[model samples]
Target chain A: MIDVQHLTKRYGRVTAVDDVSFRVEKGEILGFLGPNGAGKTTTMRVLTGYMPPTEGRALVAGHDILEAPLEAKRRTGYLPETPPLYPEMTVRDYLMFVATINGLASAERRRRVETAMERTRVADMASRHCGKLSKGYRQRVGLAQAILHNPDVLILDEPTAGLDPKQIHETRDLIKSLGGDHTVILSTHILPEVAQTCSRVVIINKGRVVAIDTPENLTARLRGAETMFVQVDSAGADATPVIAAVPGVTGVTIAARRDEQASYEVASERGHDIRRQLAAAIVTQGWGLLELRPLRMSLEEIFLQLTTEENAGGAEVPRA
Target chain B: MRNVLAIARRELRSSFASPVAYVAVGLFALVFGYFFYATLVFFAERSLQATQFGMGGPMNVNQMMIRPLMLNVSVIVLFFLPMLTMRAFAEEKRSGTFELLLTRPLTDWQIVTGKFLGAMAMYSLMLLVSLVSILLLFLLGNPEWRQVATSYLGLLLMGGCFVALGLFFSSLTRSQLVAGVLTFSALLLLWVINWTADSAGPVMRAVVQALSITDHFDDFSRGVVDTRHLVYYLSFIGFGLFLTARAIDSERWKG
Candidate 1:
């Protein structure tokens, strides 16, 4: 469990994190979404006790990060933006060193290192030098080092940043498996990763928390226009007029066809999915209906809307 | 303590893995070996029966042992200590491993002391290799083993001081090159401070000589165990370790 209250981090004339506050419940996987330079790494560093907040306080597992740093840090494992790795050491050596630093006993240190290596699928690369490994392997090695001691909290900053698509998926699965056992705060700009891996999402923009909720809830809350994608095999046929004849149809915008079938994006009032009626209308018009599906707003759209609104609101502050 | 040992073992292995450490040892052997043999050949030529090398040239036995074994060892250590200590925190910061270290349960002092001892261990290893010429003195003839032992003790103390200064400079910045240069410059300044103080009169000379690391080495080099000199070397080491701990603490707030 973690609690951050009125947190702020300033660097000289610039403020990196500005009075941001959020809580992560026990066993919850919270995805931190933000654009570049949105203070995601700074906030993660503060939470893991790598750095102290300029203002306010952060508590990890009921211990203050500033006052009881060792206790707070004991419960947290952090993977920085770039995997902090010593090039000269082998994977096993590095993980063992980290395990010892985390205060594991001799036997437990070996067990933890083996367990972490197995979990991150880096067991085979144990004997290889870290610098000689591939980027994906290096990232996994970083993950192994962070989780070697099996801390209660894990703060991973851009965990899958440099990985290829396959490696990213593997990293996502690794992170997802960590949920419910260890509270995780995953900071990344990848939208789909939040949708796929996190139980709740926290969107930060310009050093502020813009929104925090389930991915589904955020999309649902931002839902405004209801549109349906309909593909019909009717080029010359008047499909729009036929669809308008159905119930709840307000307007239809025809989209470019892919093959020879005409596609249309139909807009209707809220709580309206007239697929059956529209099918009957298409049947009556003797036109072939290929596909019909209701479209929902995506996470990307919600993110853009939230961040843009915040930027605009920031500009309006001086005007007011 | 376990963390410190773990770091020490890893750092020691890393030193062997790199060419820099080996090169440092080789360079030390070359310079120190030459100076040691030169002292012995000169002593043999003069047929001096004295047991100790006296201070300064025109070569007393005390000067022979101290200048070659003690002074030259410090000079060799001066060249290599920075190279070892430069990687202490600066390399970690550049590579982002410092963040990983902080997120763990260890305190700032634990990390700093662990790294300090680690670097010191490597330096000691290099110093041990330079002992070869001292051992070779036994083969040439019956040399005063007591004088040899005391000279070694002096070399160890001086080496410790240099390692401490190097570690402090290493913590002051994140650039290894800058750390190396600053360490070299600081040690060089200390070496010349006594000379500068002599020009400024008796009071200044007394202060500067007391502060001079080599000046303290003279006690041990003469087979004399001065408690004040021992304390000075220790205080130098403690001060550097203390500042290193504070530097690490400051980084947390700055970050």
Candidate 2:
């Protein structure tokens, strides 16, 4: 539903978004993951028709963002980083104004505003002024404004930035519930949010896209070897050599030791399962196998690895 | 047109929601009331003096009271209209609602015109309060209602020019204070442009005097509805709004 082709935005001497290209399919929740100043917000701004890209083009529902901005903007809903709220207006009035501008008729505007407020769980604060609401309520009101018209595409920048943990979780759930109906592109520096809510993830850094894939796929693609953590109760027996000698075990290192129990992190050849063989070996060596678990790489590790590795590369690198 | 009206309605609502609108209108009414009273008292004194000299028949209240009162209203708008227009775009930019407005399906022209009309509505409201003060004159004296009506038309036109100029300046900055100050300065410059006509040659003098907004307003205050003055005020409004539209368009590129 959204296509961005080689979109480049520059601010005089500095390029904010450098030849960025990405596509968001209908009903797909794409997580835009990046560190600070990673051109995430800039890309969102361009896609929303809030600003024209310095180069390239973007389309929303087949409408060119620059050439047919009104049509493009009509099909897209944007929640900027700051929420774009009039503090003096009540929540209901703000949503009604958004609904009106989004081209809803009076009856539909009323129906949609109520539904939106209900969906965002902001119904109780409908009459309350936005300025008097807390940060969490304000964020919810912002979300309500974005989804009020039920546009085909939703562009949210840091939707869960300032909320507390509970509010973040609720927001993530709300976003997840929005999937399969509204195509969403939400940017955030939070890694777990992508894992929990986003179907696919785009990791950008320094004005360039470094990686784009599912969270699980990204972790799996970046995994170098199969790693397993094993805790064995051995009576002072040197278990490292024996464990390393097992078939398909490339390396073994003791990670922790507590009395007779020693934990080892074992690395096996790619696609190899050495747990059974290692357990048999430990039993034969008169050591009790207390625990055994595979160490799957987490999204946080993959994110840090990709972003920091690119930063360490000393130049712009497009991994996609 | 619907979009424009929607935006205008919201802007008008927001203006009233803030204290700025009330303070601006109240300050305008108070200052304008004082000026109207002072002018009325001065006109009464001059009329009494004229009657003592057997010149009462020659003393026109329209010229003595309504004309100067319209001029004073113009000056009052020059000072206070910026307060109404300063937050039109500057506050939106400051609070980040500019993004919301632009991301909607509305055109730049719609947004600019809506905001201009919204500010003009507030200006009209301020003028309405002063009108109530003027109506008091009709109750106590036999003032020429037609002349009063023409002077009001002049005030409205001049106020429209002020609002357009203020909107343009507001679009140029994110600081409301800067927008207010710049608008006041720009209006002051236009108001005093005719002052330099005295030192210029004949051709240059006409050009400078023509650019003076007050010079165009003079015809309306005199009950002379010249098409030339109407065209000038309309063109002035169009130019200011055109510049404001261009300013907002440039922001899209700069963003």
Instruction: Identify the runs in model 2 with alpha carbons over 4 angstroms from their true place.
Output: A311-320, B55-57
Tens-place lDDT per residue, model 1, A1-320, is 99999999998778999999999998899999989999898999889888889998999988999999889988888898899888998999888888888888887888889999999999999999999999899989999887887878999988998899988999999999998889999998889999999999989988998988999988776665567779898756657787777788777878766665888877776677687887788876778888989877678877877887744222111100
Q: Which stretches of candidate 1 lie above 4 Å from their native place?
A: A233-247, A257-261, A311-320, B48-60, B66-68
Candidate 1 lDDT over B1-255, as tens digits, reads 887777777777877878877887788778878877776777766544333444333545555554555765665666667788877778788888888878888887778778777777777677788777667766755556777677677777777787778877887788999988998888877777777775877888889998888778776777777899889989988888888888888888777
Reported per model, the fraction of native interface contacts reproduced equals 0.92, 0.95
Q: What is the iRMSD in Å for candidate 1?
A: 1.1
lDDT of 2 by residue, B88-139 (tens): 9999999999999999999999999999888888887888888898789889
lDDT string for model 2 (A1-320, tens) is 99999999999989999999989999999999988999999999999998889999999989999899999998988889998899999999999888988899997889999999999899999999999999889888999999988889999999998899988988999999898999999999888899989999999988999988998888777776888989999987769999999999877888889888899988888788888899999999988999999987787777777777834322221222
Error of 2 at B206 (Å): 0.9
Most DockQ-accurate candidate: 2
Which pairs clash (backbone N, Cα, C closer than 3 Å) in model 2? none
- Alpha carbon lDDT of each predicted model: 0.81, 0.88
